[model samples]
Target: MAKPNALHTLAELAQNDTEAAARELGRLQGLRTQAENQLNQLTQYRHEYRERMQAVAAEGMTSGRWHDFSRFLDSLDHAIRQQTTALEKAEADLLAGRSRWQNNKRRVNSFDTLIARADAREEKVAARREQRTNDEYAARLARDNASRLN
Candidate 1:
């Protein structure tokens, strides 16, 4: 096992790395959310626009007006497709960020465990030394008292 100081240093570095990873994951999550919101808004707008176009058509619209509505709907459909693709990309990025953060966290936890074990070992050794010193002191006192009485 590594020395206590070395273990502590490693744990500190791992903690820093984990923190950076968490920050990046948070940023990725925010981006994914924004993308999803944009995609949803585009989809809703497309649906409402289509409904409006259908209602107008049912009220008897001209061919030129029909072509205009059709073209606008086509553009909306294109935009929706683009937004969907963006959302998918954002989702993928978020997943990758989450994975990175998880890995970093695992590393930090491992380092923490090692440091804890090192500390426990040190404490056990110190306790044993103290017990030995006390026992020797008691034995000497008993011997000295017996010799003085004799």
Candidate 2:
């Protein structure tokens, strides 16, 4: 049977790995949130810009001003599209990070199970040894008493 200390060390290492994985997962989630927030802000800005431009046009805007607004709106639309792509990539990364963390957690749990089983087995062996020793001592006393009686 393996030593308890060795099993304990292995379990501790597995736990550390699980913690590291969790931290990495958290970092990835934070990055994903940031990406989402950036995308939402860009979309909102584009909507507000369009509304403001429409209001200005209703006030009899010149052709040059209208052209400038159109170009700026187009750029905002392009930026929004790019941000959407970035958000999608970040989501993908977060999913992968979650998977890694789950795997690590499972590993830690398996190690814990192994340690529990080992301890149970060790206790069972020790109990059996104690019982056997007691039985031998009783037999010895019985033999000694029988010789005296004879």
lDDT of 2 at 111: 86
Candidate 2: the clashing residue pairs are none
Residues 1-150 of candidate 1 have per-residue lDDT tens digits of: 446487788889888988998999999999999999998999999899999999999999999999999999999999999999999999999999999899999999998887778878988998999999999999999999999999
List ranges where model 2 is wrong by over 4 Å: 1-6
Report the lDDT tens digits of candidate 2 across residue range 24-97. Answer: 99999999999999999998999999999999999989999999999999999999889999999999999998
| Model 1, runs deviating above 4 Å | 1-4
| Model 2 accuracy (lDDT, Cα) | 0.91
| TM-score of each model, paired residue for residue | 0.91, 0.89
lDDT of 2 at 74: 96
